[model samples]
Target: MKDILMEIIESKRITLREQKKAVPAQLLENGASEERKMFSMRRALANSSTGIIAEFKRKSPSKGWINRDASPEEVTAAYQANGASALSILTDTPYFGGDLKDLRIARPEVNIPILRKDFIIDEYQLYQAKIIGADAVLLIAAALEKDECLQLAEKAHELGLEVLLEIHSEKELEYVDSAIDMVGVNNRNLGTFVTDVENSFRLASMLPKDMLLVSESGISSPETVKNLRQAGFRGFLIGENFMKTSNPGEALGSFIKQLN
Candidate 1:
């Protein structure tokens, strides 16, 4: 599994670099002419009571298929309308079956900050994220080295994009730095595809109190959000729970209504 994950990471990096180089300089120049866009998930959460960062993921390596037919606009708008503070758009292709176009499409339709939820192993992907209208990008600590995490975080900051550094366990806390805007404790174990909300609780005490904390994966109920919030989490990233339903937004609306 380690070898497979590494292969997928490497392949993603190569594909992103090539895409970056292929963009014409003229379009790049025009896009660069405008001031860089800044998306502050921290601010979004600060103003919302629920602090739900609703996600728009089509598939996953572990889950195989979540919702391949759902439109990003319909789902994201529902999340926003239902009091979601922000949106997480999975941009990883292949296993995730997501694309940068999803981010581009969702950002313009929704006002919330859009997270480019992808396996980012190289710095070029940060620029790619910005060009495609992403408000922030995910940096999984389990997949990146300590210096790599810090370096990528700095690059994302310079690009005016927020960095959400994800940790699967307490061991990944060593990668945290000032450059990271938020720290998400992923409850899902990528190696075995097992999920437990307690994984987030177990690592909450290990994170520095100065950092904004988020819990990702395995949150399906309002009770789950209440419990995680009590454990010091400021945000919750939920995807499959809503995506698996026939109407993700309506389901999210119902979920938030229950939360309130």
Candidate 2:
């Protein structure tokens, strides 16, 4: 698993470098003016009881390919309609089989906040996030140092984009700060590639009170969400659970009905 993770990291670096030189400067231009309106991820979570941050992903490393055929527009619309507080769109291409185009296409279709769920290493991606009209960006604590997380969170904030700092364990909890708008407990162990909703349960009480909170990965049912919410998780990030089905919209509709 360590070897596989290293390969993923290397492949991501190669993809980033190749993409940087091929794309036009104007296409990646930072639209700082559009940064005026700030949609609060914390506020969204606070207002919702269910607090589901439904995700639209094409594929993943652990699960391989899932639903590459679903359009971003269709998925985002259904997620919003099914009581999702926000939308998480995977934009990494190599392993996830996702791209910025997927995120951009889903932007105008939904009214709720959109989270660009990608492996962000450089500041350039934050600007790219704004260019593609992303309302928030996911920053993994395991992938970055404390200082790096703070700097990236600040950059994303400057662009009116919320930063959801993802932590996989108690050790990573030290990186949390005011710069981040939310803190997410990724239930899946990226190192071992194992998932369990109980990971969120173990860490829920340790999270800070002020920031929005989310539980990511391994969330497949309303019962699991209920348990997590009871444990004080204000947000839930669900990915392949819905997209794995043939009809994601109906899949979401049924799950949401059960949730209610």
All candidates: TM-score: 0.93, 0.93
Q: Compared with the true structure, what per-residue lDDT tens digits does model 1 show for residues 1-260?
A: 36456767788878867776797545654573367456688888766788999999888887788998889888898888877889999988898889889888887788788899988887667777888888888998878889888999998887788999999877788888889889999998766668898999999988898788999999998998998888889899999999999988888889888988
lDDT (Cα, 0-100) at 35 in candidate 1 = 74
Candidate achieving the largest lDDT: 1
Where's the lowest-lDDT run of ten residues in candidate 1? 24-33
Per-residue error (Å), model 2, residue 133:
1.3
| lDDT of residue 161 for candidate 2 | 85
Can you give the lDDT of residue 163 in candidate 2?
A: 89
| Model 2 C-alpha lDDT versus the unseen true structure | 0.83
- The stretch of ten residues in a row with the least summed lDDT in candidate 2 is 29-38
lDDT over C-alpha atoms for residue 101 of model 1: 90
lDDT values, one for every candidate: 0.84, 0.83
